[model samples]
Target: MEKSHLESALPIANERNKASSRHVRQKLAWALIPLTLTYLTFSKHSPHMSAFHRPAINYTAQCIQPSALFPKDTPELSKAFDFISTPTFVNASIERLSGAVKIKTETFDDLGEIGVDQRWDVFYAFHEYLEKTFPLVHEKLKVEKVNTHGLLYTWQGSDATLKPTTLMAHQDTVPVPAETIPAWDYPPWSGFYDGKYIWGRGSSDCKNQLIATLETVSLLLSANFSPRRTILLAYGFDEETFGYHGAGNLSALIHSRYGDDGLAVIVDEGASFEEAWGTVFAKPGAAEKGSTNVEITIRSPGGHSSIPRDHTSIGILSELIYLIESTQYPTRLYDENPYFTQLQCGAAYSPEFDPKLKTLLDRRLHSGSDETSTCMAKHDPLALEAAKKGPEIKYLLQTSQAVDIISGGAKVNALPERAQAIVNHRINVGETAQVVFDHLTRVAAHVATKHNLTLHAFDGIEEPSSLILTHNEVLDPAPVTPSSPHPQTPFSILAGTNRAIYGSEIITTPGIMTGNTDTRFFWDLTKHIFRFAPGYDDSEGKEGMGNIHTVNERVSVVNHVNAVKWFMLFLRNLDEADL
Candidate 1:
C-alpha cells in the first residue's frame, strides 16, 4: 500500500488510547485525593436516591451486593461450558481468532464511493473466510448482505412473540503504517499465537469479538440448543471510518424491519472490565457521547505577499481558532450522569477507595442541586480536582472541542484566498448539535464583526473576505439506557450475566463510552443498547489486551476464551429472560 493509503485512514488507536489513558488516570486521581470530612447525614429512610442507586440510598449495601444470575443449568449449557473450558477447545478458538486476524480487511476514511473504490474488495475475501470457517453458522442461519459487505445473520426462533436479540461487531481494522511494520514482535497480520496472546492488529480490537460471537453461535448449534427468541448477528465492514456505509446501511434495514425500539436488546463491542481501587470493575457503556464536524472557511481575494492586507484570510482564521479553543465548556456533574453512577459504585464497593473522596461523593449524592451547582460554578475543590486531572476528565462531564484539521496558503509569495479549519466536538450528555452551532456562531459573529467581513453561517454565500461556518456528521447524545436496579431490566440482566461469569465479587456499573460506536446508528432499534465486550481490561496486572489500533496489537487466549463462554451464557440468559 502507498504511504498515502495509510495516511488517509481515520485516526483510531492513538486517539482512543490517549482518551482511555486520561480517563483511567482521572479515575485513579479521584481515589487518591487526601482529605477527611464527616459523612453527610441522610435519613436512612430517604427515598430520594438517584435512579442509578435505585432500591436504596446507602451506596455501600446496594452496589456491593452482587446480583449475579445464570440460566438454569441444563445439560446443554453444562456441555457447552465444559467444552469451551477445555484446553483443546481453547487452542482451536485461538486458531479461529488467529485465522481472522490474518485477513487484512482494513478500512480508510477516504475510501470514497464504496463500489467505485477497489479498496473495498478486501471485504469480499473476508466474507468468504467467514463462510468457510463457520460452516454451521452458514448452514443454519439466514444471512443477508447489506450494502454488499455488511453481514446480517438471523437464527429463527421457535416463538414469534419474543423480540429478537441483536449482537454486533465491526469487520474492518485500521490500516497498519508501513513504517511501523518492522517494530512488531510478530508481523501485524501474522496472527501469531505466542502461547498467551494472538498477536496482530485486529486481535484485540474487534476480530476477537467478531469471532467470539460467531463461535458461540456455532457452538450452540452443535449443542442443538434451540432458542425461543430469535438472535440477530450484524457485522459492519467500515466501523473504523464512522460506519456510514457499513452500519449506517445495516441500521436502516433493521429499523424498517423492527420499527422503533423493536429489538429486545442490542449488545455491541465496547468498554471492558478493568481492575481499579482493589476490585475488578466492568463498565458497560450505558450511553455514548455524540459527535459533529464544524467547518470554518475564511474566503478572501488573494493578493501578493508584499501587498498583504491588514489581515489575510489565514490570519483571521488563526484568531478564530484561538477564540474557539479559549472558550472552554464548563463541566457540570449531574446526579443522573453515568460517570456519577460509576463514582457512586466505586465509593460503595472498591475496598481501597479513599474515604475522604468517598465522603465528598456521599455528600454530593445527598446534596440539593442548588448546592452542587454552586460548588461546580465556584470551581470548588471537587470541580478543581476534576479540571486538574485532564481534558478526558472534563470530557466525561462536558462537550470536548479540538481543532483537528487546518490548511491555508499554497505558495509562500502569494496571500491565500481561502483558509479553512475543521473543529471536531464530541457532544456531551444534556447538550445537542445546536448548542455547538450556537457557540461557534457567537465566536464567528464576533470575529467577522471585528474584521468587518461578511458572514455566511450554514448557508453558502460565495463572496470574498467572508467568514463561513457549516457542520456535517451531526449526532445528538444517545438516549441513556435505563440502568435500574430492577433485576429483569436489560442493564441488570447484562450486569448479572457479567457477574455470573467474572464472579460475584466483580463490580458491574453503568458507564458511558467517551467514544462513539456503531450503536449510534442502531439507537432506533432499541433503547436497551449496551456497548460491552466481556474481556479483561489492560490494567496493572492484566496484560491480556494488547495495544489496539497500533503495532503489537493482540488479545490474550484467556480473554478470547472467556468472551466465547460469556457470549454463550448471555445468549442463553436472553433467550430465557422474560424481558
Candidate 2:
C-alpha cells in the first residue's frame, strides 16, 4: 500500500492498539534462554501460535506497578533540564525541528531503488542538514549510514558489558498530495510556527520525534554526562513506505553486530497518551498486526461492448470485491491481544468507565481460572460486543480488509480484456499472511465456480476467462514485545518514566500498533521493543498530533518540549537500570 493509503487508514488504526510472542520475565537468566528460543529466532518460519493454540489469559497480571516508578534525581539530570527549560534552548529546539521539516524529505511507495532514483538524493541533503544543525551530535557520536540513507548513531558507553539502549524515529515524511496543498493552513513544507504548533507534513507523524531525540542527546552531551551503557539512535528514511530500503537494511546491520536480543530495549514513535472515561491512559505499542496486499485480476475475451457477455471481466472483479468486503473477518477478543490488556487496564483503573461494562469486563478478565475457555463459556460474547463499540476498538480485534485500488476498461466502445483490484489486509494477532491468502483463495474459488471461469490463486494456473489472485508485500504479524508487570523490567521502566514525567494520574498499559512502524524490522534486536511517543493527548489524536498525514498536520510546542524532557529522563532511567 502507498503511504497515503496507510495514512488514510489511520483514523481506523490510530483509534486503538500487539499480539506478543513470549511472556517477559522481570529478569533474564541463562535458564530462561531455552524457553525463549522460539522468540529469539525472529523469523516468519519460526513456530507461530495460531489464535487457537495461544495460551489462556492470566488476567491477574498487574497493568502497571501500583504507583509509577521514579529514577533518583542526579546533578546531571538537573543540569540537563536546567538547559532544556531555558527560553533560548526552547526556541532553538523549535527552530531545529522547523529547519529539519523545511527540507521536504518526502518518500513515496513507487520510489525506485536508490542511486537510480534521484529522489533518494534528498536524504543526502537531509544528512548534511543534520550535521550542520547538530554539530555536537556529529562530532561525538559514532555515525554510520546504512544502505546509503538509513542513519545509525552510537554513543559509546564507559562500559560495554551492558546492552545498549536503542531509540528509533523515521526521517521521511509522506508526500503531501498536490491537490491537498490548498487545504493546508500553511505550506506543507514551510514548517510554520504560530507560537503554538509546528506545522508541516512531517511535524506530528515523525520529524517531531526525530528532532526531539537529537535535542535530548545534544543536551546530554552539554552536561558532559558519560553513560555506563551505550545508546543507539536509528533513523530510517523510508518508514512512510514499506521501509525495505531503510529499516530493513538497518536491521540486518544491527543484527550482525548485536546478535539476537542484544539491545537492552528499543523505543520508537507510536501511540501517545489518550484519555477515556475521564481517566488518562498512556498506551505503549507492544505488538503490531501484520499486513499484505492481495491483487485480484480477471481476464476474459475482449470484443465490442455491444457484444459483451452476461458479465464482463470488470463485473466478475466487482463481485469478488463485494464478497470479500461483505464477509468481514470475524472479530474475536482473545486474552492475548494487547487491546484486551488495554480494556482490562481501563476497567481496573478508569473511574468513569461504564459501570455495567466494567462489571462484565471484570467477570471476563478476572475469572477464577487462568484458562480462556472458562471465561469464554459465559462472558466472551458480551465482552466482544462491548469491544465493538467503536471502530478504533473493532479493528484492533478484527483482521481488516479494504479494496484500495481498482482498474478496468480503457475504451468506451471496447470490452475490457482485464480487470484488477488490490485488497489490503492488516492480519489480526495470532494469524499469519497465509491465513489471509487462503481466505482470498476461497473467495475467488467460489466466484470462479459461480461464473464458470478458470481460477488462479496461490496454487493455480492463469488462462483466458480466468480469475487470478496474487499477493505482494506479505508481512506476518510482528512478534509481540514481552511486556512485564514488574517495576525493574524494560516495560516497567518505560511506564515509570511516563509517570515520572506526566505524573502519577496517568495509567500506563500495553497497546498494539494497529498500524505497523519501523520496529517491525528490529524484532530480533530486543524482546523489549516499545512503540511510544512520550507526549500527552487528552483528545485522541488531537492534542499531541494534529491531523497527522493529512492537511494541517502539526505538533504542539508543549508536546514537543515534553517529548524532549521525556527522552532525557527515559535515557537516565534506562541507564540506571539493571535490565
Candidate 3:
C-alpha cells in the first residue's frame, strides 16, 4: 500500500511517456492501413484479370518477351505456315456441302423385329441419301459393297509411286433405348439444321469424318489436284455392331490387296484436341489406352427364403466388390509417350514456374512436394500439379475404370443363389486385358477362399491391343505430315484408326481412353494404329457439344467449318513434309 501511494504521487512524467507511446502506436497503424487495403485488393483481383490488364503490366510483358517466347518466323516455319494456310480444292468442296445434305437419325417401331428391320431401313436410307445428294461425287468415286455391312470408296491418286492413304469412317450408330429419352426438340431423325448446327445422331461421331473425306475427294476431283498418293474412303455399316461385317471384312480386303507393308496410313476417328486441355497445350491424343469388356458371375444352390444358408450368392458378390477396390494396377511411364514430354514443355511456358520446371526437366530435382507446392502457387494450378505428380497422376487423370456395372437379386423374399456383375475396364496404356484379368482372378480367389465361398469366373479375359504412334518415316507415303518427331508434333501418333483389330505394336503409346469407338475392330489388322478426331476438343463436357448417341444430338456450324479447315491443313502439311 505504501509503495502504490508513492508511485501514484511520482507518476506525472511516466504518465506523459505512456500517453506518447499510445499515440505513436496509433500513428503507425494509420500508416499501414493503405498498404493492407492495396494487398487485399490485389489478392482478390489478380486471378480473373488477364496479364494484359494488370496494373503492373510490365511484369507480364517482360516475362513473355518476344525473345523468350515462340519465334516470329523462319524459312521452315514460314513454309509450314504457308502450307497450313493454303486453300485446297478439298476445302472449297466441303464449303459447297456445308449447306446441302441433311443427315438425321432414322426411327423405327419398338414392336417385333425392331432391331433387324430398323437397322436395314437405316442402311438403305443412308445409301439412298448418298445416291441422291452426292451423285456427282459418287460417280467419280468407286464404291464397293461388302456383304450387308461395309462400303468402300476408292479415289485413285495421281502419283503412282506413293502408297495410298485410306480415310475411314463408320456409317452405323449405336441404337438408342426407346425408354431412356422421352422427347427431342428436333426428332432424332429429322436432321434439322438451326442455322448454326446439324442436329442428329451421327453428326459429330462418324458422319462428320465421312462427310469431310467425301468433300475432300470432291474438291480434288473438281480442281484436278492429283495427289502423288492414292486416297481411299472406307465406310462401315455394321461399325455399331462390333464391326465384324464392316471394318473387319474391309481390313481383310485391304490386307489381301496391299499386304501389311504396302498400305501407307489408314486414318480413323478417336481422340480430339479439346479446348480445356488446349488452354495448356495445343496437342491432343499422342496415344490412347486399351479397353476390355469383362463379366463376373457367382452361383450357388437356390433355397427357400425361410431357411437360408449362411453365405448366399449376394453375400459372395459383396466380397467381390471389396477385392476389386483393394487391388490396383501398377503404374509406370510410357516409353513411347511423346505427349507427356510435350505437355511438360507447354507447362514451362509461363513465367512463374519456368525456373523450377527447368530443374524438373533437367532431372536435377525429384521432389514431388516442392513441385506440388510451386504448382499450387500458379494461376492454372491443376494441370501443373498433375504433371508434377508424374505417371500415376496421368494414368488416373482421366476416368479410367475400376467398375461400371453390377447386377444381382431376383425376388424380394427369395434367397437368390446366382449373382453376376459386369465391369468395363478402360485399361491404362501399356497394360493388357490378360494382366488385368489375372489380377482380378488373384484378388477374387483370395476373397473367396477367405470367406469359404466358391467363385466361378466366366468372362473378361479377352485382351484388346495397345496404342501406337506412326513415325513420319513409316508414314512418309501419306500426304499429311508433321515437322518432327520431337514429342510435340501432331503426327507422332498417327497409327491406323482401327487399333482393336491390329493388336499392340512397338510404336504404341501407353494411356487410358474413357470411351469406345469403331476403331476397336482395327486392332486385329495392325498394332501400329490409333484413334482420334479433329476440329474441336469435346473431351470435357462443354456447351455447344451434343450428347453423343443420345436424343437431340447435334454439332455446331463453326465446328463443321473448322473440321474442313483442319483436314485441309493436315493434308497440306503432311504432303509438303520430306519425312
Candidate 4:
C-alpha cells in the first residue's frame, strides 16, 4: 500500500512541475515582446539599420519624435531663463506695460465699407506716449509714420547679405461691444493696474505684443546691442479694421525698399499652444483658413398680404438658410490638409490620449509624415457626431459656412418685395473661393428655378461685393501663411528660437489659424510667415482664449515680461545664426 501511494504522488508532483514551467515561459515571452519592439524601433531610426536585417522594424514610418524635431539647446539656455523670470525684472516690466495699456487705442470697423476713425485724439496721444516712453527706440531707430498712426521703425543691421526679418504688431484694437461692457471686471477702456492684473481692452489681443516689442528694442539699444540682420518693427493703425491702409501700405513700402521676397520671415499675432492632451505643444501659426462673404438675394414683385403667393421672399430666404445648414461643405481630408497632420501628431505623442487613436495614427505614419489615408471607420463616426456636438471640430476639418445676416420684410403683414443674406464662408484647404461661389450660385439657381423666383449674388452691402469675379479675395479666406519647411527652412529660424526660449516642455506642431491677421499683407513679401504671439496666460482658460476681443480682456504680467525677453533673445539668436 505504501509503494502504490508513492507512485500516485510522483505523477501528481510531475504534473504540477509541468504547469509551473509553462506559466514561467508565458510570462517571459510577454516581457520579451516589448523589449523586442523597442529594440526594433531604435534600430529603424538608426541610419545603418536595414529592414531586411530587422524585419519588425518600422523602417518607413515617421514618428511623433520629441528631441529630433527641435534644434539642440546651447549652454547659455540656463542663464537666459534666469534673466526673464526674475521678480524685479518682471515686476518693473509689467508696471510700465500696464501704464501703456491705460492709453485707449481702440479701432472700429465702421459701416461695413469705411473704418470709423473714432477717438483721434486718443490715438495721437497713444502715439506721443510711445515716443515719450521709448525714447531710446525713437532716437536710435529710423522711425517713420505710415498713415500717421502706423509706426515703422527700422533698426538697420550691419549686414545686407542676410535677409531681413519683420516683427509685426498692430497699433489698433477691436472696439469693446456695448452688450459686453457690463461683463468687464474693470472698465473696458480703463487700463487699470491693481497689484497683479492689468485691466482693460487691448491688454491681450495685440497691445501686449506691441508694447513688449518697443520695450525689447529700446532695452537692446540701451545695451548697445545692434542686430547683424535688418529688423523691421511694422505696426499697423487699422489692423483691427482689416489692415487695408495700415499693413497694406507697409507691404508696399517694404516691397519698394527690398523688392519681392524681401523678408526672411514675418511673425504676426494669431495663435499659440502651451499644452494639449497629456503633453505640451508650442506652435506659432503655420497656415490659416481662407474667408469669403457671399451676399445672396432674392427679389419679387410686391403683393398684398391677403393675396400672397405660395411662398414669400422672406420665406424663401429662410428656406435658403436651411438648405445651406443642411448641405454643408463636403468633409474632405487629404494628405495636404494642414490640420490633419497636427491632429495626428497630437494623438500619437500625447500620453493621456486614447491608445486606440494613437494606434490608428501610427498606422498612417507609414506615409512618412503625410497622412496616408483618412481612416473611414474612425473619422466617419467622429465627424458625424462632432457635427452635432462641436462645430469647432467641423470648422477645422472642412470649409465652414455661417449665414450671418438676413433682412427682408419691412412693414407688418406686408408681402416682401426683396430679401437678402450674407453667407460667410471660411474656405478650406483643397478648395477655392470660386468653387464655393459656384456651389452657392448653383444651389441658388436650382432653388430659384423650383420656386419660380429671381435669385442673384448681388455686389451691394445687400448686394454682392463689387470685385467678386475680378478679385480673387472678395472677403475671401485670408491668405494662408507660407511655411519654409524644416531641417533648415526660414521657419526653422523661428522654431529654433522658440525651442530655445520656451524649452522642450511642449511638442510643437504646425497648424491652421481660424482667424485672419495683419500678416495677410506680407504674403508676397516672404515665403515664411509665422503668426506667433509669445505670451503664456495660466489664468485664461486656455491659450489664445484670453478674453481677446471680449470684455474683461487682459493678459498676464509675467507673459508681457516674457514677450520682452523673448524678442530680445530672439533678435540676438537670429543675429548669431547663419540665415
Candidate 5:
C-alpha cells in the first residue's frame, strides 16, 4: 500500500516542475519588450548626456568673430611709418641695456628683507644713466620720481583736452640668488653683451622695456613728433614681488592727478607675440588672472615622536594638501575668459589646427547641458588628447593652483605641533577672490572634521583647524579689461601697429596674463590697459626661454631693437588716435 502512494506523489511532483518552467519562460518573453524599449530610449538620448553634467562654454566677446571682438579697423596714421627703421641701432641699444642691467637695482618680495640702509643707489645711478643716454627725452619730458625707485616721465601733449596714455615698465630686476651665480654663463649682473645677445637678469624680464621706451621717445622727440595727446612713461621699482611698493605709490599719485577712468590707455610690458609653426599668435595680456596666496596650517598636541598619536600636526596638514592637490577645482568655461577668446580667434585664422581637435573644442564650447554623455564620451577622448598635446592651451581653460611651499617637523624626536602649506592660485578671468576663499574653506573643513582637529587664529580664537588664512592678507580680484575693437581702443591701435610691423604674418588678439603684473594698482586709471611686452613665445608656447627669474637670463639685441620700434610705432599711432 505504501509503495503505491509513493509512485502517485512522484508523478504529481514532475507535473508541478514542468508547470513552473513554462511560467518562467512566459515572464521572460514579456520582459524582453521593455528591455528593448529602454535600450532604444538610452540610444536616442546618448548624444545629450554628460558623465559629469555642467554648463557648456559661453562664447564671450573675446570668442566671437574678429568683427564682434572689436570695431572696424581705423585708417593707419602715416606718421608712425616715418620712424619705421630697421634694427640698425642694435649695438647702441644693447650697450644701453647692458648698462641698465649692470646696475643691481633688485627688488625683494618681502619688504622687511629690503633694509633702509640697503636703499638702492643703482636706481639713482640708473636715473643718471637715462638722463645721460637720452638727452632729448630728458630735456623734453618732465620726469617725476615716486618713492625714489619709481620713475614717471610725462611727455606733455600739444593738446591737453585728450586723455593721456601711459607706457609702463618696471625699473627693478629680480635678485640673483648668491648660490646660483656659478650656474650663469656670465655674472647675472654683468649685463654682458656678446654682440648677438645681452645676457643678464633684466634683459628679458623688463629693463629692456625701460630702455626701449626711452629709445623710442628720444627718437620721436628728435624727429619733432609732437604728440596730440600726452604720453607718460611709468616705470615701477618693485613689480616682481607684486608691484605694491613701486606701482602702488605711483598709482596713488596718478589717480590723484587724473581722477578715475581718466586715461585713454595704458601700455605695459606683458605677454608677447609668439611665432610658432608659421603662425604668429599675439598675446596682449589685456586681462590678468586674479591672484591669492592661501595658507593652511594644522596644529595639534606636541609630544615625543616615540609616543605618537594616531595623527599629528604634520600628518593632518599633509592629508589636507593631498585633498587639495589630488582633487583640483572643477573645470568650468566662462565666456568672459580672454584665454578661450584668444583660442577662438586663433582657430578662425589657423588651418593647421587638427579637424578633430577643432570639432571637439567647438562642440564642447558651443554645446549646452542638454548634450548627451555619449556625445561627450565620443569627443572626450580626443579633447583630452588635444589638451595633453598642448598643455599650454589646457592651462588657459581652467583656474590653476600649486602647493609651492610647506613647513613642519622642526625636530626628529618631537612630534610637530604646527604645520603650514602655501598654495598659490591664479584665478580664471570670470572667477573671484571669494570663490577661491570658499574653496579653501570647504577643503579645510572636510579635513578638520575627519581628523577631529581644530583650527586656531593668531589672535586667540580656537575651533576646528578649518580656518583659512592668507599669506599676505587677501588680494581683491583684479579688474577685467576689455580690448574691444574701436578706433580709440588700445587693441585697435595696437592692431594697426602690429599690421604695420608684422603684416598679415602676425595675428593680434586679446589674451589673459597667467601671472600678475604691476597693472593691478593702475586698473582704476583706464579700462584699456594693454599689456604687450615685445618678445616671442617659443615653439611650445612658453614665454621665451626659462631665462625669466632664472640663471643665464638673456634676450637678443635684435629683439631689443624691434621692441624700441614697436614702442615708437605704437606711441606715434596712439598720439594721432582719437579717444
Candidate 6:
C-alpha cells in the first residue's frame, strides 16, 4: 500500500530535534520533586492486618445493603424479582436456550449448504430468534436492520420531549481455536444450564446482557411500566473484529435520529463486580481512554554487506527506539482522574491496610507526598515501585500503550533502505493523541541526527469523554470534591463505557476498566453514558472471572433474577429524574 498523506507529511528533522531537546530538559528539571517523593514513599512498610480482621467481605450482602445512594425500592421490585425467580421464568429461559440451540443448528445447517461466513450465519440466526420470540416488542419498537451485521430497536418514550437512552450488546463471540480445549462437559453452543451455571461461548461477553435487557423490558411491558424517555437496544455482530458491523452502523443510525441534541445515556456491557481489597466494589464505568496507532519509519541509502553505510536503516530505527524508551509521558495526579483516587480510598477503607496509614491514604492527594516513605505508605506497594522507574512506567499504570509491531530487514547480504515500527497507544484522561504523536515526533527527530528517521500517526485522535452532573453548580472548583447532593447528580464514577462521544453537555467521571469491550463506540455519542451490569460476585475467585468469554460462560440463577430487578429500578429512577 502507498504511504498515507500523514506519513508523507513528516516535518523537517532539525525542528523535531530542537523541540525534543527542550522537552527532555524540562522533564528532567520537573522530575526532582516526584523522584524525592518516590524515595520517601518506598522506605517504609507497614505490618499486615490480622487474619480475623481481613478486609475481604461477602459479595452478595454488600450489594443488598440498604443505602441511601440508590433509588428507593418500588413495590414493583419484589414482583419483578418473584417473576424472574419463578420456575415459569426459569423455564422460559430454558426454552429460550433450546430456541438458541435450534437457531444455531439451523445456522450450521445453512452454513453447510450455502458456504456463508460463520459470523454472518450466527448473526442471522440470532436475529431470526429475536424477531420470532419478541414479536410484540418488534411490533411496538422502531426496528431497523444494519447491512449484514447488526440490528437496532427503539422504544419511543411516553414523553415525546425526552431524549433517548441506548442499551448496547454484541452478538459476536471470539472464535475458540479448534485445537485449544477440545472437550466441554456440554456442547459449547448448547446453552445447557447445570442448575448453577449456563455453558456457552457468547454467554458472558454479551448474551447474558442481551437476555437480561430483553427479559427486563418484556416484564416491564407486561406490567405496563411505560418509560418517559425513549429506549434503544443496539445489538451488533462484529464487535470482536473492530465492531464494524455492530456499533459502527448503530452509531451512524443514532446520529441520523438525534443529531447533536445527543443521547441521554448509552448502557453497554462492561463495568461490574470485581474483588477489590477482598470486597466487591461493583464499580460502574464512566469513560475510557482513547486509542491511537502510530508508525515510525526510517530510511537510508542501501548498500552491500561488504560496504555498509555509516548509518544503515536498521541502525537509525534502533536509535529511534532508544529515544522512545528513554522519554516518558507526564503523570498528573489530577482529581479529574478519579480512578486512582477511588482505588486509594477503597484501599484505605479496607481492614487489610494498617490503621496508621488510613489517614494518609484518605488525603494522600492533598498531602502531595512530601517524601517517598509517606507516598508509599499511602498507595499500593506495586504502584509505588512502578512510579520510581520514570514516567513511561507510571503512564502504563494508568493508561494503555504497546510497541506492537516492527519490520526492517529484507535480505541477509544487502542492507535494507527502509524500516518501520508501530506504537499503539491508549490515551489517558485529559490527554490527546496529537500530544502523544508530537512528543514521539520530537523524540524521534532528536535521535535521528546520526540516522534517517520519520515518524507519522497511523490513526486519528480518539479523545477521552466524561460526564459531571451538578446540583446548584455553585460549589468549589476543586477537582476531587464529591459531586453535588442532588438526585440528578448521583454519586457514581465512570469506568468502561463510551460516554465521550457527546462532548461537554454531560458531566463525566473517570472509571478504571480492567478489560476491553465494545462500549468504546459510545464515547462519541452521549454524556451520561455509563457501563454497568447487575450480577452478584461468584465466590470462586479468578475462576469466576475466567468464566466470562470462556468455556463455561454463565450468569447464575440468582444473578439472572436480580438483574431484572435491578434494571427495573435503574429505569424507574432514571425516568423520574430530569437528568
Q: Which candidate leads the pack in lDDT? A: 1
- Which digits, one per residue and each the tens of the lDDT, describe model 5 over residues 1-579? 799999979989899999998999989989898998886666444434331343544434433322212122223323433433434466567778898888887867655533364655567788888888889888888989888778899988889889998989998888899999999998998998876668999988898888988888877776667688888989998898778778999999999989899898888888887753346777788787777787777767788989899888888888888888886654544556675556566566765755565555555454543232334433333224445646475555456789999998889999887788898887766677777777777777788778876543333454433443555655554566775664356677777676665565577778777777888888889988878876442332443643788988988765676777677667766776678
The weakest ten consecutive residues by lDDT in model 5 span 65-74
Give candidate 4 regions above 4 Å deviation: 1-84, 111-121, 363-389, 455-486, 537-544
Candidate with more favorable, higher TM-score: 4 or 6: 4
Tell me how candidate 5 scores on lDDT: 0.72
Better of 2 and 3 by TM-score: 2
List lDDT for all candidates, in order.
Answer: 0.83, 0.82, 0.51, 0.68, 0.72, 0.56
Clashes of 1: 0
Summing lDDT over every window of 10 consecutive residues in candidate 4, give the lowest-scoring window: 463-472
Candidate 3 accuracy as TM-score: 0.65
* Alpha-carbon deviation at 130 in model 3, angstroms: 1.3
Q: Choose 2 or 3, whichever is better by lDDT.
A: 2
Which residue ranges in model 5 land beyond 4 Å of their true spot? 1-88, 113-115, 276-278, 364-386, 455-471, 535-546
Deviation in Å, model 5, residue 381 alpha carbon: 10
Q: Which stretches of model 2 miss by more than 4 angstroms?
A: 1-61, 366-383, 537-541
How far out, in Å, is residue 78 in model 2? 0.8
lDDT per residue for candidate 6 within 1-579, as digits (tens), equals: 256655665555667888999999989879887986765554332223122223443322221212322334446755765677688987787566445533432112122222355536656667778888877787777888876657888888988777777778777666654554466666667777877666667666667777778777777776667789888888876676666556877888788878763777666776565454444455455545556666666656677979987767777767667767666555443334445544454543444543443333433433445332344333444444434555543653444446787798899979877676776666665455666666776775566533433333333322111111111111111112232223343333121111221122222223444344566555556655556666553554454453664555555655555555566556655666575
Residues forming the 10-long window of minimal summed lDDT in candidate 2: 17-26
* lDDT minimum window of 10 residues, candidate 6: 466-475
Which residue pairs show collisions in model 2? 18-287, 18-512, 20-480
TM-score of each: 0.86, 0.86, 0.65, 0.79, 0.81, 0.68
Candidate 4 differs from the real structure by a C-alpha RMSD in angstroms, to one decimal, of 12.1
